[model samples]
Target: MNSGLNFLQTNVNKDFTTLKKNLKKDFTGLKKIKVALLGDSATQFLNQALRACAYEQGFEFEIYEADYNQVSRQLLDLSSDLYQFAPEFVIVFESTQKLQHKFNSLQKSERLQLSELKTEEVKNYYHTLNRQLKAKLIYFNFSEPMDGQFGNYSNKTSFSFLYQVRKLNLELMNLSQECKNLFILDYQALSAHLGRQMAFDAKMFYGASMNLSIDGLPLVAKNCCDIISAINGKFKKCLILDLDNTMWGGIIGDDGIENIEVGDLGNGKAFSDLQQWARQLKQRGIILAVCSKNDEQTAKEPFLKHPEMVLRLDDIAVFVANWNNKADNIRYIQSILNIGFDAMVFLDDNPFERNLVRTNLPEVEVPELPEDPSMYLEYLSALNLFETASYSEEDELRNKHYQQEAGRVIAQKNFTNEDDFLKSLGMTSKVEPVNKFNLPRVAQLSQRSNQFNLRTVRYTEEDVLQISQSENYFTLTFDLKDKFGDNGLICVVVLKKEVSALFIETWLMSCRVLKRGMENFTLNTIVEVAKKNNFKKIQGEYLATSKNGMVKEHYARLGFSEAGQLWELNIENYQTKKSFIQLN
Candidate 1:
């Protein structure tokens, strides 16, 4: 019972019946999130499936289901129940069948304009909802209808329903890029994966007006829950790879670099494709680490010498290749990375290794790779392990930053005094108010940073933008750099001005910058801002979360006096803290 197989059996194989049974499970302590589901077809079953699946994902969904087929009405009307619900997420589901009916009603000339017209309508709905509500919008792209009207010619003709649906899906993706809060769920991908037979029930559509089949409901719910979980800051951040049979065909130590299968060799295409996939993940900020039980030099041979190897040594943030127990090696990697075990995905072909890691560190996600080498990519693709809520320029440079952190670690050993080391690094930071350029990363930090986050208030780009523009709120973003490299936008602070005191609404920093006097620099900066703004006192609070215990005494260490639940600092009495970092 490996974790991969167990995950598939428990979650992917769960049908409507099994999901319904989950509704009875106690959801007392699970995190509660409000969701408003709006659909153009019957969505009672979808609503139930979402709630049940969310429970399994450790979320108790408080869903507000709009009246059947009232997507436009609920969004257009300001005083509607949708607005009253004040959901954190709004899921807009427009069935393909309903979309087809609208297309069929138009003239032949207008048929070609179907996608354009529908895209505008969707944009209107999104803009209307966004203006009224601060909720993140999750819009379902239409699954192409299997109408044999034009047969294979539908792709060739722009007027066909198939063409319109696909074009609409592409337009939705483009729109999502423009709209920061908009998230387009690939319903078309999910439907195609499930196949037309399972995804749609003609009988159910006629009998109950439900477009999604009972068999397909759980998967749809799972995908939706995956998005919700990601937006709420629970998603994979790192991918751990096992060499030999895992990354390539045959063992590196046994087969040798030239003999190992990769690229055009025997069963090489599979391993090559997997490496390419891992490379893409790395490019998108998922830190890549290696944990293998092999002789250090032997494991390094393929990556260094093999022409077919897609991953280079430079691509890997952390490389641990020794005969150490993989569980212990992974623990060491986690220590350096400073990320949660649950936020990492371990991919290894050997069942024994996967099981060992799973048994020792149950929080780490070890997918059960298929026995066959060829099916590796397909199986992993279906799992959708890396679901992200946001991406920015900062994300692209994540691996390089980690590599620089490694450099800083090596540099630290030369100095006995911490202050001397900090000063030697020549640390400088660019402090600026959050604007259009850094809004995405600021919002992303608000969502992704759990360990260092005070108050644990998650914000979307929309929220960050609103705060940035408000007179009552002041925002600060820190970009740190040293002799090693630049740690892009490492810290975010949001301050709210009260009558006399300035309150810290949000204060989060990248853990990589810990013990570098960045905190002292940040506080000194904060005090300067308070004096400039004529604030009498600065107030901060440490809201305890399961992961944020490290910051429990953050205010106390900074010389803030505890005043009941809040920590207060008098600006006039505050002395500047010593910091090696200078403003850039």
Candidate 2:
């Protein structure tokens, strides 16, 4: 077993045994989220695993576990314990065998009808819960059986049990398109990757009707918590890699660039495959950084000159190759990136270097790599370190955008005065209401943004569409560009109209545009909108979270007076300040 997978398994067992150790501890002072886990079979072990995973990520989770095999009963009964708990998130885990059992008693034609009826029942459960309270629903899809009676031809036979389950999974995918709060947990993907035989234990299923084997329960639970954490805006944004033995086979300093092993031959194929994976991630908005203990010029040779290398100098957002301590190098990289330490994952081949960074900077996720290079990619995939909930067109250009920002930082050093530097950038912004064209990127920002978010509320594209159509709500997205490059969709602000006051429901901006006078520009726009709408004052609130402490005094700094926890700026007294940003 590789170190990453071995750690996951060990944590699963240790967490299950020590579940209550941090039940009441709130180290980060984040809100205690309430969650209910509803399942059709024995799910106590899964619940335990979720609690442990939540605590590991510094979230205080109040998980309400429903009775065994009582998913339908609790969802149907309005007065049941599930409704009384009033969870903010609901997870419904249903097993394939349970549905198969029902299909066995039905006729051949009734199988399709059975699938439709079950889907409708699940829809009704969501509708019933939404009518009573606001809860995001995570519905688990069916994990296909290992084998069917028809063998390999089961997919061609519509009447086969496997065919019915496959159709049901497709229906669930379609349902997610219509339901704004419904998210499908792809158990089929996880099971297919882990192999169905290992995923299900026949002895445990017959004895206690468990949905998964004891070994597989941990993976299911971990993935469930991973989805929840992503909803709460906890995910990795950067992948820092090492050069010598990690990215390729040999050292570029000792063996010349021509002698390095990176092509598709023998041991070199593994390194080439690893580079391909990293390049794909870079294209999809993951910031790539290089931290190696070697000469900087020597390290740059391969990316600059090698024909077989998949990654070039342009693909990296920050490249730091020096003889400094690995921990200190990561800190320097973090400073330039301006992201939280917890949002980084460092990959190095040497166990000594990994342990040194892990001990000094515990927040940086240094994955334990195996000795052999062949197992590197598989180990990283098994850890699932890069799971994301949303994507948009802007993701593809994120690396180039950040690289341009780095250039601006260097350009600012030549100018002595800060105002001169801001003026030199020739910054321009286009502020407009959210529309069909930019809805996906707007929603993506709401889901992933954490540090600069004032209220820390997440919304889907459907939710933003409703706000755009509503008369009482105002949705605005800001796109910024300077002389260097375009920072796509940099800011988002959602305002709700009260009788006399305009409430700032959501306000978040990209950290890349911080210290560039974007906040003053955004606030000036808000005041102009307020005056035109005949409002008395504008109100904003900052909900304190561990990640959003950087913006705790955001309103105060913008000249808004504090009224309890709410900040108010009277329209009559509002002063529209001149900004360097030219608005369009």
Give me the candidate number with maximum TM-score.
Answer: 1
C-alpha lDDT of all candidate models, in order: 0.90, 0.85
**What TM-score would candidate 1 get against the native?**
0.96
**Residue pairs with backbone overlap in model 1:** 4-368
* lDDT (Cα, tens digit) per residue for candidate 2, span 227-249: 77777777888999999989988
lDDT of 2 at 122: 83
Candidate 2 residue-wise lDDT at 496: 99
Candidate 2, after superposition: displacement of residue 180 in Å? 3.7
For residue 14, model 2's alpha carbon misses the true position, in angstroms, by 5.8
| Best candidate according to lDDT | 1
lDDT of 2: 0.85
Q: Which regions of candidate 2 are displaced past 4 Å?
A: 1-31, 76-79, 113-117
